[model samples]
Target chain A: MEIAQSLQQVKSSYIREILAAASDKNVISLAGGLPDEKTFPIDLMKPTLENLANMPEVFQYGSTAGYGPLLSFLNGYFQLPETHTAMITTGSQQGLDLIARAYVNPGDKVVMEAPSYLGAMQVFGLVQANIVTVSQTEFGPNLEELEQCFAEQKPKMFYAVPDFHNPTGVCWALETRQKVAELCIQYNVAFIEDAPYRELRFSGEALPLVSDFCPQNSIVLRSFSKIASPGLRIGVVTGKTSYLEPLIKIKQGADLHSSVPMQALLHGLLQHNNFATHITTICELYKSRYDVMYAELEKQLPASCVLKPVDGGMFVWVEIPECDTFELAKSLLANGVAVVPSPVFYPEGSAVKAALRLNFTNATPEELTVAVTRLADVLNAL
Target chain B: MEIAQSLQQVKSSYIREILAAASDKNVISLAGGLPDEKTFPIDLMKPTLENLANMPEVFQYGSTAGYGPLLSFLNGYFQLPETHTAMITTGSQQGLDLIARAYVNPGDKVVMEAPSYLGAMQVFGLVQANIVTVSQTEFGPNLEELEQCFAEQKPKMFYAVPDFHNPTGVCWALETRQKVAELCIQYNVAFIEDAPYRELRFSGEALPLVSDFCPQNSIVLRSFSKIASPGLRIGVVTGKTSYLEPLIKIKQGADLHSSVPMQALLHGLLQHNNFATHITTICELYKSRYDVMYAELEKQLPASCVLKPVDGGMFVWVEIPECDTFELAKSLLANGVAVVPSPVFYPEGSAVKAALRLNFTNATPEELTVAVTRLADVLNAL
Candidate 1:
């Protein structure tokens, strides 16, 4: 049977393919936006794990919105307004997929910063959205360009990772956040704020979610993958109750709901006294690794290549002289390192920027040092 | 924001809404197709649950296809051929959603027997598939009509619950299975065999899946929801390698993957020595419940309301004298029993038989007895 036309344009995620290759024992993989497995607070989860056996109710069918206890706990945790609500998803990635399917029509304009999260592009692409791109500055999307895109394209939504983005790790400035929220409210374009890396802030004070400024005009996706566990595949989407109800409808078809045991486990962990400290611990651990990689790149990289220091999140973007990035990535892989080429993060056929995204969270300081050396050697030859 | 045109036509699941109503303490809900919570083999899952804290790897992102060990184990567990493969879904509900999203384009014809699974109808409806239905008989789908529909409509797929079918509980005759498979292959139509209840059979000899008759022409969806646990929200879709790959692609965007820890826990539970015994235990237990419900309906239900005894599965369909099923169901709910109106099972605006689907699984025999009395009084009044 022919695959659906919607899926025809969606190439399987390149990062996933590269992540698979990066799994080789000899390779130091910075290709995936993976939280370090060692940082998973299994100790904090032990009580929940042991107690799960006694909670047979979780083993039965659950509500599509989420487990009631988890949903109630999140209301207090997020301090959501009375008018707002939350729905659980298999992951924040699924949260994006649900949003796209819920609101996006074929040929609907969906605005995103160029070099945005690849997974977001894939989800929007699956819905056949006309993905409009805005240029990214050091502080989120270029404000002038975003305003222009909103005015001209009349996009249905603006999707972004406002806090420590996936590929670039560019946290939106507070002014940028407020202005973007204002523009979205003025233009009626929903702001889809994806905050998977929000809590991973180690070196900077956290800013409010852009959605906070335009609560009724935006949806926020929060992920536990970075802080708690990706293996749990649990995510939360919060917005006006009206905005989230449609997503819940689509989610009913998407997966009924995410795993109840996982939700219960996450609820238990989130309530644990040590959970906040656990986040700080992983954040510090990741910051140290990032320091090593950043230092090595500063010390050893060729002058032609530009490097930017990230305050948080897993990756650092390295701008290279215009070259075939896929080939560069392939060569880096051959040298026992894995990094995602920048093109994968952009919409297909968009002007390709020659760059690579290197992750620091999954690898150790020594591995980060060696991986950066391999990366530098490859760049030096170029 | 306007919802996607695709979702505009879709309605929130009627069954889910009624299931919510059924949650009232005074309501004995046969509205939901939920297995008995007691039937969940938490004991079988205990060893795996305790071991989960030690396996930090499960806390990390896993392959989009599935957890490695689970897929490999299912390969052996199902004894799938060398040409076949499996992909895990959040639930069998999601397996259907993926199939619909991956393959069924809008306006594409997909065939199902009338009085089919509501979830299947919801999924196909979400994709905006042109759902063409043929009449169902006591033996299965009317063979002559199925062949006629296939030949004329040239549907993309034939979706069915071949073993202990939903709502109508019409398990196909062996000949019907062979003929459906033959017609699908001959018509170049794919067969989507959703066998969630295949393992729930309490009587009659187990038969080979319709897919077994034409392996290359079919995809089989197997659910652990009924047997293992729905709260885990894990299900498997298996078919030839080529047939299954597109689903994995759609699944990557669906939720990245099912919960890895849940997948690992499911994997470990599947490997437990008592797992097979657990299935037998549930089958026996549900059989007793089914016997009670069937007996009560046979003894007390008016002759005007025709009842079909199911060999297995959670429901028994009662074809009442032509009347408004929705009103009847509502009145029954008011009298402290909750059942699904049959119209929800058919495609929107399709001619709905004046019948109701009554679940026999979740409630105890005593509850079932009282629920049937309530149902009988309502129907007798109607």
Candidate 2:
């Protein structure tokens, strides 16, 4: 059977290839956006795991919207307004895919930063959306360019990782969030707020979500993969009832619903008294690793290379002097350090930037230091 | 924002509405295809649930194909050829959905029996497939009509529930299965054999899967929902590696992978020594319920209402004198029993046979008796 034309255009993830290669025992891999396995709140989840046997209801088919108790808990936990609702997804990845399937027609315009989440690009690409990109500033998307694209393209939605942008790690400033929300409302565009790393803030004060300023005109996707467990594959999508209903309909066809036992386990973990402390612990641990990597890069990297300090999240973006970054990545991999090339994050055919996204979350402080030393040595030779 | 044009044509499940009404305390509902909650084998899963906390690797990200151990176990368990591979889906529903999204282009021809799975129709509808329906016989599909449709439309695939079919509960005759497989191979049409109810048989001897006749030309979907648990939402799809790779690509964007911890739990449960006994216990329980429902329908329904005894499956289709089944279902619900209308099963605007689908698995024998009496009373009045 011939594959769907829509699927033909989607390239298999390049990062997956790099991650596969980086898994060798000799490599100090930073190629994947994975959280450390050790930080999983398994102890906090023990009660739920033990109690699942007592809850016979979860073993039966559940509501397509979500496990009802989990949705109710999230409503109160997220402090959703009466007009808003929460629906659980297989993961936030499914949430994004549903949004695209529900709302994005082939050739429909979808805006995103050039350097954005690779997963988001893959989802939108599968739907055949005409992705429009705006350059990014330290604060957020370039407002002038964003406004021009919105006016010109009349895109259906603006997809973003506003908490700490993927590949770049730039959280949108308060003013930027408010302005982006205003633009979305003014242009009748939905703001798709993907907040997978929102709780990973280790240094700076948290800013309000872009959707907070335009609640009726936005959809928010929250992932548990970072703070809780990726293996559980549970995520939440919240928006006004009207915005979320179509996604629920699409989701019904997509997977019926996510796993009910996983939802119950997540609910139990969230309600635990120490869940907040658990998040803080992972954040601090990640911050220490990030500090070690950043300091090492500052000390050893060639003067031609430029790096930025990330307040939080998994990655630090380093701008290398212009060269063949893919070849550079291959050379670094052979030297026992793994990092992602920048091109994978951009829409296909977009201008390629010479950079690498270095993840600090999964590695130990010592590994992070050694990996940076290896990375700098390769760059100095180049 | 307006929904995608593809989604605009798809209807939200009418069975869902009937199911909502069915949940009333006073109603004896046969509206949902749910297994008996008592048969979930929580005891079999308990050991795994407790052990999940100790399996930290399961809490991290897993391969998109499936958890490694589960895939390995299924390989030997199913006796898959080296050329074939198995991938875990969120559910068998997801396997069907992935096949549609990965292969069916807009206006591409997809063939099914006139009265087929409602969820299958919805998934194909969402992809804008030009669905062609062949008439179904008690044994299986009308062979002449199926071949004619295949030759005329040249559909991308033929989707079916070969074992005990949904609603009708008509298990295909052994001869029909072999002929269908031959027809599929001759026409170069992919056979999508969805065998969710395959293992539910309590009396009949198990037959080889239709795929066994044309392994290279088929994709098989197997579900644990009927025998194990639905809330876990784990299903397996197996086919030639070439046929399944597209599905895996679609699944990565659908949800990175299904819940890995759920995958691990399912793996452990499948490996337990008592798991075979657990399946036998549920089969016996469901068989008892089916017998009660079948007897009650035979004793209570008017002669004008036709009933066929089923060897296994959750439902029994009752054909009534030509009338509006939707209205009949509403009346039955008003009389404190709920069932699915026949029109919802057929493709929209097709000539629908006046019938009702009554589930026997979830309800008790007493409720089955009461529900049938109510159903008879209403039909006799009509």
Candidate 3:
């Protein structure tokens, strides 16, 4: 039972550790990025799933490319460029894994935000990429630092979450989006834009997609995990055919294809309801939950412990002055609250000190209020 | 974009190319190993899928390990050793991919049959494993050659298909299965037993599983794709916790988890029906089709062209005495039939000459008769 050298490079995810620790049933978990299950379209899904099981195609093997109807739907929905192609993945996580395999050689340079999606970082690490970090400002990755890494590191891939980034929940400004895309083109790098939370916006106007800015080299990863159903595990990666051919080749050996019944179910849902209406309905439900948690945290937490309000997405980033968030998280877990510390999302030596990410979607208004008060008390004591 | 060095090693799958070429709507493809859709449990699934969709848990994110109920079902079904554990995969293909990542380091030696599953070979290629091939005799891999390779190559893993092997419909003898397990222990190697078609047996006494012989290092992969439904993409990998731990760690970055709705649907099916009765029904259906094709080929083909009789499995391996099967396959496709040539299944230097693999599972008895008649005509002419 010898392990591969690459396995040594991967660490068990901190989120998994936190979630397991949160399973005491007494802990209020703000650790995972799960969308509230109550908001799932159970009423709408009954007929859709019934229709899917009757179709013989749902019981047969699908093309490695994807389930055809969903492929057509995604191609139209994403408004992919004529030269670009779209392939359905098991989820956005598989999309990242495919991209990493397509472009990364062991020790190849890759770039990411200081606090990015932890899952993406794990994929890059498993591939043994030489990861470089760029610091983030409120708007996006710091343009100056990004340019320096692109110039010096010459990374093979630059992974970004331009819209409603995980952990940070910060949407990139329109100018920053364009600049990041341009930097990839100039540096001859693949821009891996993960946009799972793009449709979860509660208030702010949508910015241009990084793919929209540079369609040639930029690859976009989208998921139905948040907006539709995570448990069904449907997602897609879109890019120019030249880059996608390698990803598809690697994907053939990965999982063959995603589950066809899941794809057919999503296709049926799209046919039955307007996609925009579905997004808006879920947004309204999560918006109020976000508001309650933000308002209570603002009232209870000291000014030194800042809770940054997000316009959209699941997480609210908090900065605790002169406190280690990891130690604080352990203490808070003992006090019946759970939050994700910031270190797991960073490249070593570049982690933000005293930062934590709190998820607002899963908790009810009352549960969120109580959880934040407990969190605030722990922060104030520190 | 610069493709990863690993991608250079991956030749595009011959099955994929054959299937793509067969999509012209004229060719009757005996190339892919797709189960007959007519046997799919649509009546049983209709209510089950509907019920699953209404459960909020089916639409939310699942545990990375698996859906709990299904995990419990498999853990019991396999009757795993006390030291062993099991985890769900998107498909058995994913199970193979995870095993490759968990054990293969660059240029590590791995053993496989000369004519093995093409997809597994592709996974080994993606990881750049030093694949050592052992020639197969009528029953299984040549014992003497296998022992020589294990001793000399000192391979990290020995990948075997002890039951209903792909491309070549050969099952290992009881003694051969035990010998493989004993050698792996003797050489400190992992034995990867892929059992996708194990349950599809229409006749012949069951041999003990390789895992039953050596639980310490054997990782067994099982799938519902052949027996239940391919579109659901449910599969499992079982092994001692020592081997499973790395696989679980690697699986986290792969796809997070298998689709919960699909797992629940399968779980519901198992709960609703006698599993043995379901297996018997599908096996009877495919066995009739297999008989039709084998009878037709035996009657029409020349003496030099031999069709091997399989006890039970989807594929029938044919050896063409003096003709190139690749060229024969191309000519047959022109005559409205498609078959997979043996070269794709072999190691670089050891391809079995003038052979082809024909799948009997997907087609009807009528279709299989026509397909073999056309194939026999081409073989006789050659």
Tell me the interface RMSD of model 3, in angstroms.
1.0
Show pairs that collide, candidate 2: none
| lDDT measured at residue A148 in model 2 versus the true structure, 0 to 100 | 99
DockQ of each: 0.89, 0.92, 0.86
Whole-model lDDT, candidate 2? 0.93
**Model 3: per-residue Cα lDDT over A1-382, one tens digit each:** 6689998878898899899999888999999899988777766666777677569977898888788888888788778778989998899899999999888989998898888888988898888998888888889999999999899888888898988788898889888988888988898888888999999999979788987888998899988888888998988889998988988898889989889988888887776656668789889988999999989988999899766778899999987786666888899999999999878888766756668899998889988999999998888887
lDDT of 2 by residue, A284-347 (tens): 9999998898999999999998898988999999999999889999999999999999988889
Better DockQ candidate (1, 3)? 1
Single out the weakest 10-residue window by summed lDDT for candidate 3 chain A: A345-354
lDDT of 3 at A246: 89
Candidate 3 TM-score, C-alpha based? 0.98
Candidate achieving the largest DockQ = 2
The alpha-carbon deviation from the true structure for residue B53 of candidate 1, after best TM-score superposition, in angstroms, is 0.8
Q: Write down the worst ten-residue block by lDDT for model 3 chain B.
A: B347-356
Q: How would you encode candidate 1's per-residue C-alpha lDDT over B1-382 as one tens digit per residue?
A: 7788888888888888798889899999998888888888898889899999989989998888899889999999999999999999999889899999999988999999898887788788888999999999999999899888988888999999988888888899999999999999999999999998998989999999999999999999999989999999999999999988899998888788889989998998899999999999899999999899999999999998888877888789989898888888889889999999988888876788888888888999999999999988877776
Distance from true location, Cα of B23 in model 2, Å: 0.7
Best by lDDT: 2
Candidate 3 or 2, higher DockQ = 2
TM-score of each: 0.99, 0.99, 0.98
